[model samples]
Target: MNRFDTDLIIAGGGLAGATLALALARVVPSLRVTVVETFPLSADALPEHYQPSYDARSTALAWGSRLIFEELGLWPRLSEHATPIRQIHVSDRGHFGATRLNAGDHGQEALGYVADNRWMGLCLMRELLETGVQWQAPAEVVDMTPETEGVRVALKRGTETWSLSAQCLVVADGGRSGLREALGFQTRNHSYGQNALIANVSTGESHRFTAFERFTDAGPMALLPHGTTTRAGHQSALVWTLTDEALDEVLALSDPQKCQRLQERFGWRLGRFTRIGECSHYPLKLTTVDEAVRPGVALVGNAAHALHPVAGQGFNLALRGLMTLVEQLRQAVEQGQSLGDLQVLGRYQRLHRQDWQQTVQFSDSLIRIFGDAPAPVAAARDAGLVGLDLLPGAKRWFARKAMGLGGRRAVISKPGVARREPAGHE
Candidate 1:
């Protein structure tokens, strides 16, 4: 038998990595876990762009994700900063078609919640500290070696070099996962020839807890409800997709000038777009790893798949997959099975395969179908929206997919109660 320093080691202390530790700590109390992070855990110690939590961006948490957070006892802190999405309005600009999805339609409290990355991180950070998981921050993973029963991780912290071993290694690093690449994982990437510009914008009329997704010639533009500004007025986080030919010109515009351009594209849905925050842009791509696990190594979050932001499904899909992974690990521990065993990791990959494939197809198809500018395509898009609105069954299906409540869900019976494991883990 081989002994390891820790039961599991999670690389990348971003949202996925940190959340994985916290979730496992709650369910698998005896398992020793450690997290390796490159950024400082202290929020005040880093700039907005550098901070893992304050990446000048916001995330739309599906209703299912909220349940996962609630089960982990992190929702109370997060809800304080989250803006509920009571309704979602989707349309195509200059088209006579639109659709609306309300929380009342599905018996959910709200369709979903929108939270800034910084505050959400703060909430997760609080829970992370309580978990007592070992943390190695301001540190980078220099190299990793996968053995028959465990993995050896090399860390470079300033002038010091440290080595650690874990029974199982989880690579939750971001899309450009250095650790994953070092471990010989293959990734397929397809560039969409588009760029996403994100920022917070103040509007003339109140957002009324409504989110908007408007399709434009440039691309899909989304404005999600954000919390109130210091002045007590409404704000919305903007995610505008544009072509590469327009990226340079758009990013070069002044705040007010950018707001004007946004108004011209988005129309008077929220009346006039007033104040705008600092803008950030990133190229769009569809990235998927060929394999999510091998023997002692398991991949999670963006390291496994990075999808287009068109449907706001990236984080939601990742969260669902994380829940499945946590459940499998808990089952392994209860059955006295090795966490690093190929059987245990292979089950997780099989369970998550369907959800992964569906989400990627949904996001990729939206980009390709909407990106083409033609009369027939425009007519088809308009008809789809109109049909979706008129058909209750179709509308419910669409709402379920958008709200992340369509598939099988992991249940949390009550606070402090161990979840019952599903059968078939032998």
Candidate 2:
């Protein structure tokens, strides 16, 4: 008889958790998997059709992410609502340093793509419903205890409580993960002392599938091409960084006044800002856990590391880590080793640690170099930008890093691996 209730139990079912579940279902169907989530999910709850909204939240998927999804057979549906980033424009406000990277110059169709968060969740949920993975929604892991060979978790659903054991437990709740704290994981946080104002705006001219990253003395701002153009005009998702005081002042202004302020800071690169939608803001911080793995347990996604949104590298990095974990787990199954073996999990961490460190440093450096640099440093930064634009090899290197192709790529698929029925539960 099987000793555990499930081979793997994943806490939380948001983007990161859901994506990991779907990836595992595709790569290792033989392993029994169960996902515990706070929010309820059902076929009846999902929308049959997706309608794009101006204020809808979105995520940027780097080019490498596209390859990962294609391997799982999800890109076909996801691309339906995705807007390709054909070019990227990086510049410093009030300075002549600016660089433009074209997808054609890099021998690719697009550097990345942006898709609505709701629509992406819809795609992931739909695919997950058809898989063999079990679901426990409107439920959560109240607490967990590590054992010799596995972990035991107490789950609470509505008024009822139950216990289950799993050989491996994956905590992917979110940035503010309660499970992570309950597990006693230590973390380091560096606050940027800035808040990001997010909204969707329409301009007088088309975006031409271009994304803009403009840095100012206050902070950095990004404009990603949103969905298709409407009679309202071209649209783009705005992520404007501001001090706490500035954010309050801007949020209190009328729409037209807000547009004027934005125009002053962003210039007429996309022509005049005609309309702005509802606005939301969140504080920016760099949060990282001391260790991502322990015997019989692991953390993925935001639970492991939360980065600044200006760089748009958080989700892409998480996707890479989860895929690497899946690869290592696949090897464990083939070698007849315990899924929760420290050696197995450590190898996964060791293989992915370099990418994790490099990405965090890259994102952090961008903010520090431009946030409040001295005059001499500012001039050097500007000169560096100009040199990056002028040199072909340097441009390629920068472009690859931005597109998430600089690190070691994870192997997400193997041909001729047939699906097998999961082991029986006690």
User: Worst 10-residue stretch by lDDT in candidate 2?
Assistant: 417-426
RMSD of 1: 4.0
lDDT of 2: 0.89
Give lDDT tens digits, candidate 2, residues 156-263. 988999999999999999989998999999989999999999999989988999999999988999999998622223899999999999999999999999999999
Best by lDDT: 2
Model 1, 264-296: lDDT tens per residue?
999998989988887888999999987889988
TM-score of 2: 0.95
| Backbone Cα, N, C clashes tallied per candidate | 0, 0
After superposition, the stretches of candidate 2 with alpha carbons farther than 4 Å from their true spots are 229-233, 415-426
CA lDDT scores, all candidates in order: 0.83, 0.89
- For each candidate, what TM-score against the reference? 0.92, 0.95
Count of backbone collisions in candidate 2: 0
RMSD of each: 4.0, 4.8
